[model samples]
Target chain A: MRYMEDTLLHHLHTNDTEALKTFLFTIEELPLLQVFTSLSANEKAIVFRLLPKDKALALFEALQPTAQHHLLRSFTDEGATEFFNDMAPDVRVRLLDELPASVTKKLLQSLTASERDATNLLLGYERETAGRLMTPEFITLKKEMTVEDALAKVRLQAREKETIYTLYVTDQRKKLHGVLSLKELLIAEGSQLIADIMSHEVIYVATDTDQEEAARLLNEIDVIALPVVDRESLIVGIVTADEGRHILEDEAIEDMF
Target chain B: MRYMEDTLLHHLHTNDTEALKTFLFTIEELPLLQVFTSLSANEKAIVFRLLPKDKALALFEALQPTAQHHLLRSFTDEGATEFFNDMAPDVRVRLLDELPASVTKKLLQSLTASERDATNLLLGYERETAGRLMTPEFITLKKEMTVEDALAKVRLQAREKETIYTLYVTDQRKKLHGVLSLKELLIAEGSQLIADIMSHEVIYVATDTDQEEAARLLNEIDVIALPVVDRESLIVGIVTADEGRHILEDEAIEDMF
Candidate 1:
């Protein structure tokens, strides 16, 4: 990591774009997909032209909606279709929200049935609200699970989760019981029960809460992320700091002009 | 320099106010008086609170007139008196321009006879023009000097000047004839005269030109700085890229809101 950082700094100092591209290509084996997701629209377009089609589409799905439109306009019909098809349901909904109704209709016609339904469900909420940003990509732990068993379950399910920084603890009825940070789990003795370590005074926002308000609360408290819960207080999804920063930057830009 | 930068970075990151004050106290050997003069009003206030009373007053006098007022409000009568005594004539004029008449009169009374005369001369010019921002700190060279001789003279006089990036090449009458970058001097053979290497096509802004327009002109061209000339096309002062960037940031902030 230090060597890669040093190499990137050297290239930046010399303004060597070719060297930078070579370095980026070599580091594609790492979890660079997350870093690629954080780039601005113009920056993504520049990188997209340098990477493989599949990698480009994967990165595109991770981009903010504004960036998706920009990348789509820069590509041919076949390329655009490949990217649109590979995008996640929640991400697709965000893109559709920004597009004209006629364009949205045409794009919706291209999606599979399940993708269309998932996107439709997400699109029902107003933009810049918790419901619109939340993804149904999280793990729910049953209260009956022992500390050892819960840890094993988390390790098995971690790959598919958005973040494991904060684990949402719920009851058998699917109602959120408490929340626990990953730090507490690592330090706790294996014999200790999960319910003993978890804090029942859970801090979370409702599905309809304003996204800016959610972001502000997270920033004020210096938390890694916040969980979004439904009307019945069941965990829906989490809004991580990376996504919150993107939303904040967008808000700052909007306020600037 | 690297050590100082590291120490400053450490204090900034840790928000260690006491360490910052101690670090500034230890740097008394360096000629910070000139550096303080270049900083904006807001920057001065941030740094001044950490310094001793004597050093603070000396630093305040080095600042521009606009900065002086801002700093004055943060000091006592004794501190203000010491600062006013040390302030340059032209800077005093600039300070009085923005201040209310009642306050300006009180400040003027505090200045010595010679300083008051110099202040009056600078105050005669219109605001937001080259006449307002320019310091009378410049050196004019005869167009006939050998490259070696010119370099030696610059080395001797550069300490008091704002910038030695671009030296104005003038005829015997002190009329601006051409301009030359410091790069030309270092690379030129000893035999060449200043006239031979200097570019006759000098781009300069008039004393009355808008400050923002002057900054834009400097940014558009690949020049280290632009020379500000009076109505008769006599070079007065140079506006460097450092100052240009500061002006651009201010404009960007104003446009932001």
Candidate 2:
């Protein structure tokens, strides 16, 4: 891997796109991110430019928040918009929070309306609150459904969901009633009611709850996802295991800096 | 919350078990764990002794590993046994790793034969590797079964599983062939074969892969559990998102001290 890292640098130095592509294809995302970040700023840009769109997005997400901030400054406005548009909402806000106000304003305006609303809703919360980190893209279920019906709902909507693993059971008022993992749904008899299998003890965090506290609870309980609710206990968004991980990774990086 | 914290502490000082229980019932696990941990050693013992068995076990698991270490030494043998006997396998190893050799040896003998074997497998691995943290408790499947048959298998076998959310499809030789999330299983038509719905792309790690790396992959992909394989490519164990959280928590606590 070290040999490949060096070779990647050598390829970048010589402008050998074919050699770099061969090397990158031979490695995994973790190693690719490592090699890309280990390069000098100019080399990093060159390598990043050469990456395919999906790989580029993955690499961008994998970069340290500081590294991401640096790249934001270096990219053309169109390039920045492309990256920002695909990035996770929390990630986009975190990067924006670190840049100069003038720069952030210009970048922020380029976001599409729905993305802007989602990002702004999170940003409106306190810096380290659950609202700031929770993704608004979760799917919800209704209690009036059978296991088969819920399954159909999840299938139709699951593609766009941040997580369909833990489906929230909510009322017409959007108030949470119970929580159910897809495991329970899968194992249940098809005609069985979701309410019969769903657990009523839904562990949730308020929108204003501290992010670390929420993440810690999420971890301790070993749930793949936790619901974030408003003060009235209506489901608003969901904080996922990945976001909890990103918090830890960002903290570790912060410690080193 | 501050008032409740103060009131609980005061009640503990006054030996007010009734008031304390009332206060505890009104609050959630996160705050209860925090308030309990903040108490004096004498008070902690008093409160712990007063706690119901389930709550005590929860508190024991919620503690920082070092605090768990101190409690092991501080408690009477009977008290310590109750705590140790049911602690999660990976957590047991972590706590035992921090104790004196003689203490660990004595405690090691108390575990059931199967638990001892599982812990020893993890102990045999290098620190920070997947083998050290991977749990031996997991459910595997075969691809030839119908969804209904698989669901029945899951229902019968699910209780002992560390996770049934991400089911592995293995061949006759116990070689993993594909992966299927419970979501996919739930949404599929009941008569369909498991092979038809299961994904061929399985993201996994060898037993010796870095725990953090495997964990990062699991988190990035937002899977409930990650399978750990041996050199022979047979599934050995699974590492869970909760365990990932535990690893990060341990790291954060280590940095603090």
Number of the top-ranking candidate, with lDDT as the measure: 2
Query: In candidate 1, which residue ranges exceed 4 Å CA deviation?
Result: A1-257, B1-123
**Stretches > 4 Å off in candidate 2:** A1-128, A187-193, A210-213, A255-257, B1-133, B145-152, B187-197, B207-222, B244-257
Q: Score the docking of each candidate (DockQ).
A: 0.01, 0.15
Give candidates' CA RMSD values in order. 24.6, 22.5
**A-chain TM-score of every model:** 0.54, 0.54
DockQ of 2: 0.15
Candidate 2: give the TM-score of chain A: 0.54
Ten-residue region with minimum lDDT total, candidate 2 chain A: A97-106
| lDDT tens digits, residue span A21-57, model 2 | 5666567788887677677655654455445445666
Q: What share of the true interface contacts does candidate 1 keep?
A: 0.00
Poorest 10 consecutive residues by lDDT, candidate 2 chain B: B97-106
- Candidate 1: tens digits of C-alpha lDDT, residues B1-257: 55665665476446554576677676763455544554444344344544644565455556678666755443333433334344465644433223222232333444443453444332333556655555444456677898878866665666656556578887653468998765466457667898898989999887668888888887778565787765456565567755665687699899979
Interface RMSD after interface superposition, each candidate = 27.0, 3.4
Docking level for model 2 = incorrect
